[model samples]
Target: MSRIQQRVAEAKAAGKKLLVAYIVNGDPQPEVTLPTMHEMVAKGVDVIELGVPFSDPMAEGPVIQKGHERALVHHTSLKGTLELVKQFRQTNDKTPIVLMGYANPVERFGYQAFATAAADVGVDGLLTVDLPPEEVVILKDALDAVGLDNIFLLAPTTTVARAQKIAEHASGFLYYVSLKGVTGAGHLDVEDVKSKLAAFGQLTDLPVCVGFGIKDPTTAKAVAQLADGVVVGSVLVEKMGSLEGQPAAAIATAVGEIIGGMRAAIDSL
Candidate 1:
């Protein structure tokens, strides 16, 4: 199995849903990002979805938009993000890292070159938010050649035909947008999300992870019962933004508390 599949499967075997944490690379400051990542791993984050800061992150709301702005001030490029992953892998190699961003950067970075750099830096997956599966053939082939998983997102508005198409293209896991709006825009209705996941489950065996509105321990635990993974984004980014000038340990502590609480809640389920 791939590193992502192994880690996610291990969570399943343990009777607990995986906790996937998202952080914008170089947010607040570049130096603190890696330490904060390690802290999340220590506090029970099963997988890391590192956001590659982009100029136009249409899928993000205010909280994540602010994060991208902060990271971009330091000029965090696609190559720089890959360098951060390489630094991260020097000590820790087990936790999977998924690069979540837009397609413009990858296109500029050259598809083949980006895939090779990503694999060399220990990146396990890619989720280009704006890339539809119909246009994903070349990029998907490049990623497949390098043994990296290409993740796709499905939304509540997606029709059955579209869902099947996405499922066919998705590799690591299928990220199901639990709401109709952008990330951090709506209140997550657990029942509605459950029904959507149930329908997708019948279409493919790919792990369907719910995201976009999961903000707290209560919601995380509730969603954990229905999906293979739970992804928390804006809330954590907000916390990182709040700790801008503070020490690295402070950022770690603040983020760790939120993830640790959700971890406890999911395990108890």
Candidate 2:
């Protein structure tokens, strides 16, 4: 099993839900990224979805869009993100690191080369936001060869047939976009999410992780009760942005507290 699968399996065996945290690499500043990542894991993040800065992050909301812009100012390329992962691996070898970004950078990096380098740097998965299941074969083949999970997104409007098709290509876990819009867009309707997850349960046994519209411990707990995991991004990124110009330790502490609160809330279940 890949690190992601193993981590999820471990959480399942222990009767715990996964808490996947997302943050842009080189955001605010490149130096702060590494410390924040370590603090996040220490505070109870099960998997880390590190965002690679892209010029046009279509799926991200204003907060994360600003985060990408901030990272871009520091010239955080795909290779730079990989180097951060390599640095992260030195101290932490267990937590799964999944690179979340667009397809253009990956295409420019070459599928085989990117997959090889990612695996070498301890990356566990890839979530290309705009890459659909139909166009993911070549990339999936490369990732599969190196034992990296190719994660996909399933939206609330996805048809049953389309969802089944996505499940066929997804591994490690399925990221269920809780909101119909971009990341951090709408209010989460718990009942709506519950019903949708129930529909997904019939199609695949892979872990379904709910993201978007989950901004606090309350929402995380609500989603945790319904799905295998909860992915939190915008709120964290917003928090990081608010703490910009502060010391790295301050940023890490403030962000870690948010993760800690969610962890406590989820464990309370």
Candidate 3:
């Protein structure tokens, strides 16, 4: 099974919520990004969604936009991001790494070559933002050839027909958008998420994870109580930005505090 699938199964068995952390691969530069990843793993992060620096991330919000800009300032690209993953494998292999980004970079890199390189560097899955279900079939085949899972993202606006189609192709896990707007732009509606989950679950057994605008322990805890997993990106990215001018230790320390609270929410459950 895919690591993400395995994680869901294990979390289900353990009656725990999956804690997913996301960060741009080279933002603040990989010098800090790599260690932050290892730090997250050490703090028991269930999965890591490393954003591949794409020129345009339409699905993302301002926080991630700024992160992409920061990553670009350091000349981060698809190939360089893959190299960071390769370096990550030198010390850790257990934490699942999902490359999340837009399809533009993958196309620019040549889809087949990018998938091959990502798999070679130990990436476990992918979450391409712009590649809708219709176009995903081709990329899915490419990833499957390399033994990688293609994670599909669903949202509130998704029709039953759309959800069903995405679920059919989804392998790693389904990322259910908790809100309608871009990442970090909306608030959680427990009732709404519950409603959507109920509706979407009718079509597929894939473990559903909710993200977008999830910011703190209260939100994370609430999501853990509802969804199978909770993904935090913009909040963490914002935290990274907040630690500016502080030493690397301060950066790591601040992140640990944020992750700790979110993790506590899951543990309390």
Give the TM-score comparing model 1 with the true structure, all chains together: 0.98
Lowest lDDT 10-residue stretch of candidate 3: 244-253
Task: Quote the RMSD, in angstroms, for model 1.
Answer: 0.8
Question: How many clashing residue pairs, candidate 2?
Answer: 0
Q: How accurate locally is residue 168 in candidate 1, as Cα lDDT from 0 to 100?
A: 91
- lDDT by residue (tens digit), candidate 2, 138-225: 8999999999998999999998889999999999899999978999897899998999999987999899999999988999999999
lDDT, each prediction:
0.92, 0.94, 0.85
Q: Scored by Cα lDDT, where does model 1 land?
A: 0.92
Per-model TM-score versus the true fold: 0.98, 0.99, 0.96
Cα error, candidate 1, residue 191 (Å): 1.3
Candidate 3 regions exceeding 4 Å error are none
Candidate 3 local lDDT, 73-174, one digit each (tens):
888988898898999899987778999998888888888898899889999999998888888777888898998988989999999898998888888889
Query: Which parts of model 1 have CA positions greater than 4 angstroms off?
Result: none
Provide the RMSD of all predictions against the true structure, rounded to 1 decimal.
Answer: 0.8, 0.7, 1.3
